[model samples]
Target: MSAYAYYPGCSLTGLGKPYDESVRAVFAHLGLGLEEIPDWNCCGATSYMSISGDKAVALAARNLALAEPMGLEIVAPCAACYLVLSKAQHTISGYPEIAARVHKGLQAAGLAYAGRAVIRHPLDVLVNTVGLDAIAAKVIRPLTGCRVAPYYGCQIVRPYSGFDDPLRPQTMDRLLEALGARVVEYPLKAHCCGGSLMGTMEDIGVRMSFLLLKEARARTANMVATACPLCQYNLEAYQGQMRRAYGEDVTIPIVYFTQLMGLAFGLAPKALGIQRNLVTADPLPVTV
Candidate 1:
């Protein structure tokens, strides 16, 4: 079994707790092991970069430094964390001056980052490392009748399109199909879910989320499967507000892809934190 250095960013500890639980449960069910990086810090996500690019790279580099000694590729479940870490790696290697500043920051903290550690999202690990056939083999309860809309939500594919197509990603679609789900045609799969704007710019955020949810519903999808914590939270938690804004009850259970994987793996709902979601919906019926 291959092991990865796991990095669960801030959201996973709080609003995305269910995602954290399901990711762990699903990976364990698949015989994959994850080791949390020791003393790892924040990835300085979207906000930090806008304020100060150098400090943002430095902040993300610290976590990379912590994981370098382990020699395992860092697998982040959070989209923001994955994007930030990947961007930091790219920036440090591409520019000499920025790399020097990042190195100095690490030195001040008595750590050294060689920019050698690989960063990946859990989706990348599952599809590329774990393999779809292996995942399909473990599906004890096929999601036969479930119509799912795979929502990638902007970050994982873009600015770094190595693992999947930037505009039209099929990784999640293919994975869900392997698990026996009826994957729907979701044009807004890679669209923005407004990120932190849901808190600051409520109208714009609600509208963005509503459009995705509305599109999924229009396609007759029962649930929206997401790989990003913020996407899951924004889509699921803001449904009531979205209804008030849009005058339509656009509420569907926005779930983590890992959570669905756990269900398909025959893990109990509690183990996958399925009941923890704010948007309550009947659990997807599993085929025995």
Candidate 2:
């Protein structure tokens, strides 16, 4: 099988390095090919888009333009990157007025935009393209006792519900079950994890993060399985702040979904970047 053009986004190189490591590890283990696209730029992130739509699309479209020549689909692991790339693709394909401006911007940089690049979230690829039974067959260390709250955050499914349900996503839930883990019925799975909201407004953002993190714990999940780097960071790194603001200690292990999959595949914790997690679930392999 051909490898997908991997776009690590900017966040994946920073606090989200574990996510990068685990995603690479798991995909490699599953025999999926991941070619990191050369000279890939930022997807303009959320903040940049808010400041300037034209410039933001121009910024994000460059990555798509680069990937087009590669003749492979772009697999964006970061939620913001996935959304922005998807939006950029849509803008260039559907909005002619903006597309002309974006094309002009790309030409100045010695690149071109054709709207042919396809952007995908890795989870969608693994669960939808790879198939669950195939993943189950590779599991050497099943997550039998792992009760995971599959957090989807507000991006991914929203604005583009092509992969799963917008309101009630079940991709991660089913994928976790396939790995021999029990899925907690997390109602706010699609809710915002405050993302950069915590950075600008401490109280409101922390409150949002605290409530969602608290809900997962309240529902009896021992850990959270997230796809977005920002969600993982906001939910995991701010536990202490959340405790202070919410007056409840709802701290629990927060991890990338790929990390748990790596665990089930019998990959070592270090290989999956499990040691990089702030909260420790330190779980034994579940037998289902």
Candidate 3:
């Protein structure tokens, strides 16, 4: 009915700024609106989940409670935030003890949680709510020869995400096809991108990302399109790490799906934050 309450999470605001821009740009091009939820706090990502489930849910609860006033669905672009927020909602709703504790925690900040906030991913909103045919009509330039590998990573549709089938997600594949790009059949679409494990376990993470890039390249995918910032970072930033692991080079530009949408809409590359990426997305030719 109205603009979504945008939640940037830590990654989107810090490391994933381009994603945030492109998501806004594509939404604007599609004639949709997104209003950032004011004074939003962290969803605690995966870090707090291991230490304390209650505190992490409380952190996520605060953001959900804040969105109550806006009365709009919360669109979280980062996959980790999406999962954590969804988990928080489930945890709060399923457990009366958790609900009571989180409610008390929110009350201390002049806030309350009635579980009114509806959390959604940008992909879910764009493809489901906005519709691909509607998006296709807005494309000023079609990605004629661009071969894209749709990587859903491990979080977006996992556990609680209801928008798409988690194991065999086709939302991105279908959306990219609408943009005129060949969607590479990626077997590792839902595979783990090593996520924070890349930081904590270095080589293991690099090798995992290396597999995704290798597969995309093997399938003749010129670039990898993903909805998660951490997936983009791990895949794009770590191609140089495990060169020995791959018999052949596995370097490919990993980009947000929204950037491709912007290109199809004739939006500027700079505006989509293409230059912000470590691996130059120079090969994705856009005919304006």
Whose TM-score is greatest here? Answer: 1
Model 3: lDDT equals 0.88
Candidate 1: where are CA atoms >4 Å away? 286-288
Stretches off by above 4 angstroms in model 2 are 284-288
Q: Give the Cα lDDT of each candidate.
A: 0.90, 0.88, 0.88
The lDDT, on a scale of 0 to 1, for candidate 1 is 0.90
lDDT of 1 by residue, 29-66 (tens): 88888899998888988899899989999999999999
Q: What is the lDDT of residue 255 in candidate 3?
A: 88
lDDT of 2 by residue, 192-271 (tens): 88889789987888899898988998898989999999999999988999888768998898989998899889988888
lDDT of 3 by residue, 17-41 (tens): 8899999888887777889889888
Off by over 4 Å in 3: 244-247
**1 or 2: which has the higher lDDT?**
1
How many clashes (backbone N, Cα, C below 3 Å) per candidate? 0, 3, 0
TM-score of each: 0.97, 0.97, 0.97
